[model samples]
Target: MSPFNNTTFTHAVFLLTGIPGKEDVYLWITIPFCLVYVISILGNSLILFVIKTDSSLHEPMFIFLSMLAVADLGLSIATIPTILGVFLFNSREIGVNGCFAQLFFIHFSQFTESSVLLFMAFDRLVAISNPLRYTSILTLPRIAIMGLVCVLRGFALILPLPLLLKRYRYCQDNVLSHSYCLHQEVMKLACADITVNNIYGLAISILTMGLDSLLIFISYVMILKTVLSIASREECLKALKTCGSHLCIVLLFYSPEISLSVTHRFMHSSSHLLQIILGYIYMLVPPLMNPIVYSVQSTHLRVRLIRLFVK
Candidate 1:
């Protein structure tokens, strides 16, 4: 018997899962997962490097972009180790503390990403509606404060989850759905009354991502109103153009997340395999696509990238 099977409630060791019933294809699956991780890590790193080096990119928009990149990097790094471990070495045992830590970082990064996206929406709103006051309003100190708040908010909100989860007696099944620890998935395995865990987890999700999404939607609506009210067609187009990259990122970041959230909440009869795949998509897609979308959409970033590579 595996040593982890001797798990006790207080010192439980959870077995992380990869694709269910596809153990033989682990090697083949690692290729795409590894590729995505490489791209996300390298891509976000390059974005940070370029933004740091280029003085012209030191505006509020780019500063927020850097925050998003940092969040993506954190999110990617948090999950990739266990994922690769499961796929490459068939290692899936995760201790309770380690699992809790992973769960903390994963959700922390996610919450931070959501906050940063909302901030970016606000940034766009300000840039579009009040162009002259953009720099004045989003000064360096204020931007720094916003970044700090993003970190703090995520830290405060997610720190409680692990503690709450630790209190639960996980004496039943210790097998997790994904190759990494997730709070929702972990909570499901608890044999004790998880009323508080369930409620707290739901509250955190609603307060963080849910609130951010609603605010972002409102910001865009106001942005649209401002754009339509502009007198000159050229000016209106120019204002809307500035928001395109951010809009694409907001969509990319939120779509999979919202879909997965809905699946987990409403679709009780959903396929376990499909839910697992959606979980992967929620974690993988944003980090992988954020940098790509920005690179393709932002002419300035594209030019700098080209110059860095070609020149």
Candidate 2:
């Protein structure tokens, strides 16, 4: 018997209906997307280059920043090309296998990004809470181990995606609603029982992304308490400045993800457009904002970037 016979599969459809009189909207969307992609690439590349070339940036903080940049770049690349393809070619159709592949990379990079942020939070916490032991604690070997853990965590979180897809039965409609494949959206297409998939997905989210966010929040809370306890006002202000940018970036990244998850679970159809917009925002905005946040808030990175570009 065919998979479709054994399982229930929903057809993929474009998430948005074409605008009534706006054939030009395609151009509008594509141009802005391309611009954002280019900037994201350049900005993240500049950070990577600076970290590699500047000996001073060999510390744990910059190492985490570099990895975060790499993750952001991966996240942007995974989603943007497919989105651009949809806008430019009107080809939003994705097969079951293709949908699974997209879902894998998107989730992989997303989880990796979250892992990197968690490491960053820990790095900040160490620097603030135990400055004397920070260096030894966050040693190069430790950083390497953390990096490996992030990679492993990403694969672990995404490994079940294909297996889940394999169990689903697809109907004649294979068009995906969004520009790219989203896990929940694709799961919604399944004709077979999706209780297992949904449960596993939620379990992963709670254990990994959700738990990581909570830990990061706790780290910052302790960090703030430590900073306030410092006797030197100047030192306290300097330390606060160091964390402000990261705090903003973390909030920006997690807030949308939490919102999207809540909306997808409870208010999917009505919030489809909002979901699409937030999806793009989460993927693109973080990378675009990273450069600005680091450069403006961290004098060292800002100086290095300026000097490197000038030379």
Model 2's alpha-carbon lDDT is 0.81
Worst 10 residues of 1 by lDDT: 1-10
The collision pairs in model 1 are: none
Residue 34 error for model 2, in Å? 0.8
Separately for all candidates shown, the number of backbone clashes (residues 3 or more apart, or on different chains) is 0, 14
Give per-residue CA lDDT, model 2, range 273-308, as digits (tens): 677677777777887888778878888999999899
Model 1, C-alpha of 185: deviation from truth (Å): 0.8
User: lDDT score, residue 235, model 1?
Assistant: 92
Give residue 269's error in model 1 in angstroms: 0.9
